[model samples]
Target: MDSDWRMWSRRDLLAEGMGRRGIQHAVEDGWLVRARRDRYLASTAPAELIRAVRVGGRLTCLALLRLLDVFVLTGGGLHVHMPPNASRMRSPSDRATPLAGRGSREVVLHWVPLLRSLGADDPRVHLVDALAHAVCCQPARHAVATLDNALHRGLVGEPEIAEVFAALPSKYRIVRALLDRRAESGTESLMRLMVRAAGATYDLQVVIDGVGRVDLLVDGWLVIECDSEEFHSSWHQQLKDRRRDLALAQRGYVTWRVTAAQIMYQPEEVAAGLRGLLAARRGGR
Candidate 1:
């Protein structure tokens, strides 16, 4: 029952008064499943964490951050952290077999050690380590977004942020200048980068006299709101958003709505679109 409520070591079960026979009986009774040698999982264990254990690595970096509800710009596969010399990897899908080849792309693996290990039964990388690994996993802007997301959610403060940078090489320190706690969402962090790359200036989380607070204001006229499908999909929410847009428009502010999907799945397209509109604005047409 202890140890993050899911993964457990054999010693953990033994400490909980489960002897050898008792452990076997629990497995047979479907109360527990053997995750690996000396490792076990409760029936209620999360499939993702189980996958990390089965793959012979800890869930980490983007994979773990996304699981913790932090901002991750890209998504594709399960991310894992293992020692540089670890072996006997199994397929994440079926725990029964070993991986067929050198490595599977489906399981993104990080052999580099960013931080000290956590408890044996803790199937996740430490949050600070995960953040450092994420810095290595993503491009510059994306990495900054992830850091901002962590800060905005109060998951880590400036000291922890300093620890993350300390784990990285010196060149990465440049990204520290871009980290801003005010970014309300990962999307806003990304949108801010896109706006800058478009050669436009913006004020983040700015408020106008007539309109309420906005995600970002570009050149004092354009307001960009990073919308997510889950929150902005409702009829009522859409009406509210439309009204907000109109209100800004009436006050000589142009509002651009960017969806989460469009930003993550279509970055180049979004950047191109932003450039065109920003150019039009600069031309005063």
Candidate 2:
């Protein structure tokens, strides 16, 4: 096998005789990609890491939310869960923090000592990771999305959610409540929060006269759609959305569509633009 691909299947390398210098050489030679100081990936790591760094390393929180297909606004830095004792072993570059868990660095690591009590099969790990990151990052919508995704993926159940809620810091009660609400996807939830923040009053999943169930409605005058590129990037879907917009417009309902990028990165701009448009409509301008 290629040296770059050696880390995945080599249990022996993870054992004795493995030193930092050997790992560093492997990284320098492109034989391995360093995910953390002691942890290496023999293959290309998840592209989300690069994206996360670009967005200020906030991708882990949002990525985990996305993995759960929950609705959330992406926010700052990769939040990692690391065991308290593991901090001494990590390099400064790892950017790890102490949390309640004992996890090896696969992605971001948060060191929390409490993770030891949970059963190995429990999905609370993912929930705690997402929630802790969300609380730290202030991506309340994204936190909700992660929780929704966890529920949808069967990675977490109702009881698990309760456990997570109980474990959360007292300040994160708002995030916990947001997570309690059912959401279809992280993108949608983020958009909803954005719209609400913009002072747009509308019913979610409201049925219009002919537009079917729109994702969001604004004062019975506008329809807002949140598009996730992963699912809506296809030409057919784009065409369909355009058709739907045109049909909605013909029926006297204004349509505004927001993409995941806009919702995640430029939320204020999106909200401001929508608010301006709504104001103009109200003024009959």
Tell me, by lDDT, which candidate is best: 1
Q: List the residue pairs that clash in candidate 1.
A: none
Per-residue C-alpha lDDT of model 2 across residues 114-188, encoded as one tens digit per residue: 422433212123545565555555556666666665665576687767766676777777766655344455666
Stretches of candidate 2 exceeding 4 Å from the true structure: 1-80, 92-109, 115-130, 152-154, 180-182
Cα TM-score per model: 0.90, 0.62
lDDT of each: 0.85, 0.58
Candidate 2: global Cα-lDDT? 0.58
Candidate 1, residue 43: lDDT: 68
Give the candidate number with the greatest TM-score. Answer: 1
Model 1 worst lDDT run, 10 consecutive residues: 1-10
